[model samples]
Target: MLKGNAYGHGASVTAAFLASRGLPLLAVGDLTEALDIGQAPQTSILVLSPPLPEQLPLAVRHRLHITATSPELVQSLSSLAQGRNQKVTVHIKVDTGFGRLGAAPEELVPLVKEIKKCPYLKLGGIFTHFPAAGGDRIFTAQQLNLFLKLKEEVCALGDCDDVLWHAANSAAFLTLPSSHLDLVRIGTLLYGQSPVSVGAEWDFRTTWQFKTRIVQIRTLPKGHSVGYGRKYRTKKPARIGVIPVGYSHGLELEPLTTPLRQIKHALGQGLKGQHFVFHPMGPLPILGRVGMGLTTVDLSKTPDVYLGDSVTLSMRRVTASAHVPRIYYLAGKVKCILANHEVLSPTGRKISLLGLF
Candidate 1:
């Protein structure tokens, strides 16, 4: 799915690359995101979220597949398609276990029947989402079983040979083989994020990196406090490197995952540094809480590190800002750069990557 700006990797760039590689389909969150992929006649774009009643016309006009969550939505889509004299493709979102954005399992038969009654609507696919496929096996199994049962019931209604039934997300795709019915909607895994413990075994490589350059360097006097709330203090004279990135840039210094984990980390870091950023020589610890547009890192360990040196920070791909420019590399050479809706070559000349496909 090329949603969340392809997990902040630039949806248009990733979608075009995927299409060029013969990927048949791409999924997005809404109509606006669907239209961001530009015009790709050969590839099918599925809007996973149910569109508003008024948005049906745009979805149909754009030839985008949509999610049918209720009888009313199906009816609305059918009516819109009929008015336009076009066959609208739709996927039935059966809520097997994920308590969000899908019709209940019991509503499957009625929803399918409603869709079948709409002559202008085509049942393109049926799917559900797994909420705990990575951590809870029993719950995932239950959800899978429910989805399969509902699939059987829906298929029995009419000719469902062309309907694609899918439930596996990234975690389910890696751990649950049986959950892979007809299609797998990989998200985090496609960007090299694994929610499972054995994710390292998969031959997936990271497709994104968060990088910034040091803008300033300062020597903090002993006993000087750092950042808001005066969280960190310098015991001795220390060198601090300021990088132009922080919460605003989606670089989270301290990700409070769990209470227990927090307690463990707090105890472990007793008097030592907490979060760190990467330098070729060694790790540079963060001095304090991340601010809006600036972060201070301890650079005492490396004397050679100076202003304009690149610093790499860890970040969640989906949460990163979409405004960041995306530089595409082909075989390790810069091929294209996409920023603010403009496509340019390495030398800054306007170009079209669409012709390559």
Candidate 2:
């Protein structure tokens, strides 16, 4: 899945590399993200969510595999495709138990029949989402059982046995072997973050890293407060290093609004500590609230650390700011860089990541 800017790892660059390696289909959230991946003639792109009514034609024209969550949408898409003299591929979304976007179990037969009736539409795939597969085993089993029964029933109906079915998300793919049907729609697993602790045993390496350099360093008095609401105060004189990445860059801070909560946090800090940046010697504790563009880390322990020294943190990749540049490498060498709309090479030559396809 190359949705949410490839989980904030630069969609175009990731899609280009994956497509070059012969990825059959890349899924994105909507048409805009599909457009961001640019033109890849050989690779198929699936839009996981329903596009707007006005955007359906564009999706058909682009040959994007679209999601059909309802009979109404399937009928509308069929009309549009028929009018354009185009055959559009569609995946039927089955809401086995997720209770989100998807046709109900009872509606499956009619939905499939509707798709078969449309001469301009092809039933490419069927799929569901698992909201509790990561944590709730009984519920996940129920959902899986329901989907399996539906899949069998759908396939038993005329000419639908070959319709592809998928349900495994990152967590289901890892923990529930039965959930792996035709294909898996893994997001967190692809980025190497385990949805559950069982994944820690797997030899999955992270493909993304968040790093920034200290932009400012200064010493504050023993009782100096840091960040908004004076949330943190130094017990002794301390040195602080300011990092460029902050909440605006997708670093989340815990909300401490009440005075009691603030006091509890202050008491807990001495024992449990808080979020920190990694260094060779030790971890540097982050001081107080993360601001929009700046985060302060206590640097008293690492006196050798200076301004411009790199500070690294493990962040939720999907939430990171998309405007930040993503540098792609192959064989441990620089291949390309993507920033917003521009793609560049190591030598500073402008290029398009999609142009390679």
Candidate 2: segments with Cα more than 4 A from true spot: 197-201, 253-273, 355-357
Instruction: Predict model 1's lDDT versus the native.
Output: 0.85
Candidate 1 residue 276 C-alpha distance from true site, Å: 1.7
Candidate 2 clashes between residue pairs 3 or more apart in a chain or in different chains: none
Worst window of 10 by summed lDDT in candidate 2: 252-261
Give the top-scoring candidate (TM-score). 1
lDDT of 2: 0.85
User: Model 1, 1-357: lDDT tens per residue?
Assistant: 889888788888788888888878889988899888777546899999999988887888899999989999998888889999999999989888788989999998999998888899999999999888988999999999988888888878879999999889888988999989888888887877776767345787768778888999999999999898899899999999999887876876345676766886787578564878898878889988889888999998899998999988877677777666778887888889888877788999887767644
Please count the clashing residue pairs in each candidate, in the order shown: 0, 0
lDDT of each: 0.85, 0.85
